[model samples]
Target: MTRPIFAATPVNTPVHGLSAFGDLKYPAGFKQFDYANPDAPKGGIIRLQPGDWLFNQNTNTFNTLNTFVRTGSAPPRMELCFDSLMSGSLDEPDTIYGLVAETVTISEDRNSFTFRLRPEARFHDGSRITAEDVAFSYDLLKRDGHPTFQLILAEMAAAEALSDGEFRLTFSGQQSERTILAASTFPILSKKELATKKFDSGHLQPFLGSGPYRVGRFSAGRFIEYERVEDDWARNLPFRNGLYLFDIIRIDSFSDRNAAFEAFKKGETEWRGEFTASVWATEYDFPAVLDGRVIKREFPEDQRPSFYCKAINQRRERFRDLRVRQAIARCFDFEWINRNIFYGLYRRNQSPFESSPYKAEGLPGPEELAILEPLRGKIPEEAFGEAVVQPTTDGTGNDRRNLREAARLMHEAGWTLKDGFLHNEKGERFTVEYLVNDETFLRISPGFIRNLRSIGIDATIRQVDPSQYQLRLIDFEFDMIDVAFSLGATPTRDTLMQFFHSSTANLPGSNNYVGMADEAVDQLVDIAARADNRQDFTIAMKCLDRVLRARLDWIPNWGSANRRVAFWDKFGFREPKPDYGFPVEALWWYDEEKAKAIGK
Candidate 1:
């Protein structure tokens, strides 16, 4: 349930979590993860800010308590309520140890897996977790779970419960290592609860789970809090030991960031990961920060690489032409924007997998050409040259050379300047509104809007609430949207299918928001899927990056390799944070002396 902090970057790195093939970095009897302190004492009340930080909407609204269903937006960190069969180590890049399941054994052909549930694993009501419950949970998910679950389980044949303590999940020959990993990661629900309550409906009643925390008290759209269970099962499990220390975790609901910032300054919220760079650099002069009660830190990102790009809805006829899309990309002045708006904290990102080994650089090599040659006419010829690079403008906020090139591209796309508006022969003015959920874009939007206007394009910005935005996005009801996605250098087939395959291109709730449907993408993704080793996967990934750069439509944007985080000083964490992100919940513990000194 760890989602992206940004649009596409995963909150948890793949290597840090339960891996698909049980190829774990830790052995069977490993005590604890290197990132986790087995001896750390656990006691504290941690208050966190929820809702979408990318859009700055502090409404903190969550309508449905059932997080797995598609009815409404679920609260943040809803995944914490459920326990997966396995858990990942923060120190490793791609590995998983047993959690609910004590031991896992896979078939030699890699088509079947048998898991033995831990004897101590129990549900919230103290009923022992059994193989029947696992089978029932799989049945429920296949029948009425999220679309993602359906896609992930497409290759899974069945989850057969043989006894009270053991179950076997068999898959088709097309099953992937990533599929096995996903089959193990679902939140196991109580079969007894499913027998009494409806699983498909949106309700305020929390679903019964077996995790360390449970939903205690909540007021719709205002606030919700999770209380830790003292008798919670699996606390001593090697994978879960010394985690979830906070007795009470309260998610503060706010109307705006100003109110949230004031509450954090006053210690109403425990800590926040600073998203806005300017705010991190200039806005820490408050009394708490000046007095050293709070700390600001930057952690380098070591997981998948991601980039923010303005996604042009190609389903619309206006963007069907490649020249039009390229013209739009030419309009964005990344150099000027990074210098002034983003406070020079970001770098321009041109490839889908920016700054990673998978990123396509220079001309195609022999391995890449082997993949691209088959689809010569199917892909753009420009892809044969150097990878598509965005126009670089001197930081004067306006560059005449790029503007002239953009003008030519626009003209070639049959858009002529008419009384300050780009009009076609049919008399429709070319216009697009940037759809957003948060008003934070209003500050940096003027610059992009001004540049679009320079090319006689009628561009505007539209902001909506969080819930409405989610609905519209699911239905693909926007003209253009700026979205970021995480793609690693050697991503697994599970991720490649969701991100690039044509099979999920039109799925309503799938991540194919750009509606990309290209044969080359489908082929490249298949190559990545069927690859048997890392070298093969790397070749497929590089080929994917090259084709995606020329074929996919998006206005290139910026990226940040470091995570800007700010937190209170009372919490103690071990040295050597993971290369990907901060492991706050698992490793950070309450410091009695620091809290006393800070007077918390």
Candidate 2:
């Protein structure tokens, strides 16, 4: 038989790190990660708004401190309060170094892993973090945690605490080779703290933590602060040196994006990641930016595949037809919006896997064709030809050529203009309501809505509060919604399954926003996940991208390659950030001399 793809140590040997490709960057007993500065100072506050978030996190406002469940909205960066079995490296793609567990040993069959915990590991309450806590955390998450966690841990068969300092996890044979990599990064909660409380309840009280920071003070929907732990247990660990340097990390919440921008302009918040192109180009002329007190610059985005688009709910019967979806996509004029609204700072997005090698390009190569040949009868014929691209429209507000084509396609789909509105043969009007949480979409979506009206479709925008908007999204209550997401540097099978698999199409709170349920796409995802090497993985993913683009369920939008940010000049950081992620609050520290120079 062929050797397993993940080649670990022999049954008795333990290693300091684990990688997907059986290679580790840092050797045993390494001093620190290459991206970390060993002498970075560790004090001062950094005030900012949330730039990115994970499961159950809402950037606008929060009602609960428990972010790991699906019952309520929570603030970002709550992950700082918990420790995991292993932590990931910033510069590498799929390697993880030990954090709470000192070393790990793999079984010969590759179905079991044993992690030995450090003897000195302790929780914030001065209690020892034992193997039992790790076991309890996994079992609880697999049963009562968020839906995302349930989907990821579906293949885990058992979690056993071999001893007070040793833990073992066994997986079913059906799991992918990289499932352990995702499992190792889950936060280990305290069994003693959560055993008496409800795991799924929405509560403002924080859990006991062992990571670098703890929840300090917070209101229900306004602001929350994380105070750095002075006696952090893993402060000097090889994987954690020169990180979490801020004495206090504060995150404020505002219902409106423009209000948050104003806060940054007045120096109430120290850092602001500018997302609106019009504001970035014209509104930086404030006195602070005119002087040297505030620095406005662009930082390179993370090197990963991202999806930014409008997802039409295929669960609704009106959007189930491919021709209708294609016609709706043709109505969007990215060229006009880019020039007139975005100030020519964005590029038209063409593929779901944007900025990655997995995106299907010209015609399918020999390797990709080998994967697509068997699925020919199931997928679209266009998927076998040159990759599908979005239509290029004239910069004129009304592109007669594309608009005429859109009208023809809608007519062919059994939707004809009658009494100034497109109606199907069954007398149902073609209406699309764009659901949003704030007034931000009012400025950018008018052109698209106007184009839709010109084609005799009833297009409208509906604005709701942040909480209600989130509730509607969870219930799949909207006709169309805009979603932007960044996948992991090396996405595994389980990660993609949550976004495209049929099993999660109707699952509540799942990320399959378009309600995709394609058998050929599911087969391609499985083949890609089972790849033993990077070359084979790339081929399978390119084939899958071709099929997804041909379906036209998600209409491509615009994207930028860099992050537009403005910050006060009181922080010091090393240049040339890491490739995979940019956690500014953890990497940058206060410069006292610069703060004095700025009269702060």
Residue pairs that clash (backbone atoms under 3 angstroms), model 1: 15-93, 15-94, 17-88
Taking the tens digit of each residue's C-alpha lDDT, what string does model 2 give over 475-544?
8899999998888777888888888889889987888989999999999999888887777878888898
Candidate 1's C-alpha runs over 4 A off are 1-23, 50-59, 487-490
What's the lDDT for all of these models? 0.74, 0.88
| Candidate 2 Cα misplacement greater than 4 A, ranges | 1-3, 8-12
In Å, residue 343's CA in model 2 sits off its true spot by 0.4
- Cα lDDT of candidate 1 equals 0.74
Tens-digit lDDT string for candidate 1 (3-96) = 2111121222222234432345675577766666778877887777642321112245777777776557666666777898776555554455
Best by lDDT: 2
